[model samples]
Target: MEMLYAKWLFNGKEILKGLGCVSHNNMVVDLLPIKLAKKTYPEAVVKDYGEGVLFSGFVNAHTHLDLSNVSIEPYLGFVKWLKTMIETKVQANETQTDEAIKKALDSLIKSGVCAVADISNTLKSCNYLKKIPKAIVFFENYSLRKKQAQEKIAYIENNIENIRQTYKMKIDVTAHSVYSTHRDLLGYTMLKNNPKFGSDLFSFHFLESEFENPFVNSRGDLFEMLQEKGLIDNQLHFSSAIEYIKSLGDIKKGLFVHCVHIKPDEIEYLKSIDASIVIAPRSNYYISKSLPNLELLKNSGINVAIGTDSLASNWDLNIINELKFLYKHYSHIDPAYFFGIATTGGYTALNLHIGFKKGFYAYPFFMETTTNNALEEILQ
Candidate 1:
């Protein structure tokens, strides 16, 4: 048995001082006051970590590991960056892609990420994710043409079925985004994955860019791409992406990624549905040069989580760096709050329990610093 004490301790909920944790066999047995821990575990070895914060390992709620090899810089715009990413993937051979994924996984582990909610356009990452301690692999789907919705759905279903039969792993099929996936395809996927069908958790990219609004209303470059294929009608007028998605069915249990343009009313609706909002601030700024209103999200009492997005649009796959970026920009919000978003909020989003409790794996992360500002020190 061992007792570890730190100046500050986050028990996956709140930060407390003069507290410590006791663990054995990689499991956290209890969290108690430092003095009490010393008394209760008198024979146990004590490691007093001075002047830093110790907390649960990070849970990266969203990422695209397959796109790890794409360039992080040279982003002209959201659409252009996306095109470049697609082109890069098309040109990358299997060996390069595998190497990129392996490198990304190594970086994540070194950065102390204990759980991941990874989005994959291909099944190649599955072989590596199975070796991780905790991960939710989301098979991505994209179909812009309405006529191809059924075909895409059939293909995705078959792919998911084959994945289950071959790897025997729990994989979730999710829509790429509102603009990339046809409404019919989203509805079909949600219906098929509903409890009556398979009870699989649904995930979708919400409004991650301002271009999404014009595309959904049939007027932007994205819409023009679809128009070239004769997919959408020029006369059609659609509401906000949130409304269109709600019009289809219940998305309360689903995971909504990015949400950079989510409105106030939409926040309430999302909260009502018990949906999770994943904020990729760095990726948002990297692609669109904009970020979601962090103040608005915090005031809405919604469950918000942080994600590093992908190396294609981010500097690295480190969740700590994402938190540091947020802290540096949104200095008003308490670092402890962001800490919750990085740890508990992420686990909650993925529906995984990784709190520091008895029988739970004690995936603790520590940082050494002179300042009591946990977030600032971690960033440094």
Candidate 2:
């Protein structure tokens, strides 16, 4: 048994002072006032981390471990960066990919991330994720040709089954995006009644770039790129990316990543579906030179979360660094709110229980601080 007292303690939901957590067998048993903890566990050892903040371990809601080796230089546009990523992957080998995955995992663990919702095209990181029990592997699917959708689905299903049997890790399937995946493929994965197609959790990139809008409308550089690759037909037509996704069927209660280009009505629609909006502000800015309309998301009463995206688009995979970026740019929002998003919002999106409560794993993170507002200082 051990007791840990910190200047500020975030118990998943809110921040409190003069509180200490009691741990037994690597699980949190109780959280009470420091005095009460001392009285309750008189025989237990106490360790007070003065002038610091203690909170639940971070949850990286979205990342691509396979793409961790890609360059982090800011691209002129999202499409240019994506094309470069594809080219870079062609040049990369199995050894390099595995090494990059190992480095990314080490960086995440050292930075205090306890859970992750990793997106993977090849599911190459399945072996690594098996060691991190809280990880949810999102097997990505992208096929713009209806004729090839079934084949792609079969491959994804096979991979999912194999991963489940071998690693025993949580797995789910998701469309790459509205523009990148065919309507038939999206419908088959999201609307099909078969147990194989249904997962309680689903995630997809949405409105990450303005080019997606024009691509969905069949009138942009992205559309031309698709045409050059013979990925889209002339018959394709959608007013907006969000509308096209909504037409697929109900996709509520899932992580909608990179909602950086959504509008007011679309925000309301997302809220009506009870979706969790995950914003990777740094990645958005790095690739597209734009950030999400956070004020709109906040005003709409939507549940917001944070993600590092991947080393491809981000400088590092630190959730605290992501929060600091948010606080530095959007200073009006409370740091506590961002903390909640980094902790509870991420765990909720991954379908895992927050560990800050009793009986759960007490994987607490400590941030050095001197100010009374430890969260704010940590962000600084």
On TM-score, the leading prediction is 2
Would you give me the overall lDDT of model 2?
0.80
lDDT of candidate 1 at residue 328, scale 0 to 100: 82
User: Relative to the unseen true structure, what is the Cα RMSD of model 1?
Assistant: 2.6
Stretches > 4 Å off in candidate 2: 131-133
Q: Model 2: per-residue lDDT, tens digit, 45-156?
A: 8888887888778888889887877775795588877766655744457788788889889888877788888998878888787656478888888878877887987776
lDDT of each: 0.78, 0.80
Model 2 TM-score is 0.94
lDDT of 1 by residue, 118-211 (tens): 8887867888887667788888877767667778777765566677678666678887887777777787666533543345666778888777
Q: Point out the worst 10-residue segment of candidate 2 by lDDT.
A: 83-92
Give the number of the best model, judged by lDDT.
Answer: 2
Error of 2 at 332 (Å): 1.7
Model 1 misplaced regions, further than 4 Å: 42-47, 156-162, 191-193, 196-198, 229-236
- The TM-score of predicted model 1 comes to 0.90
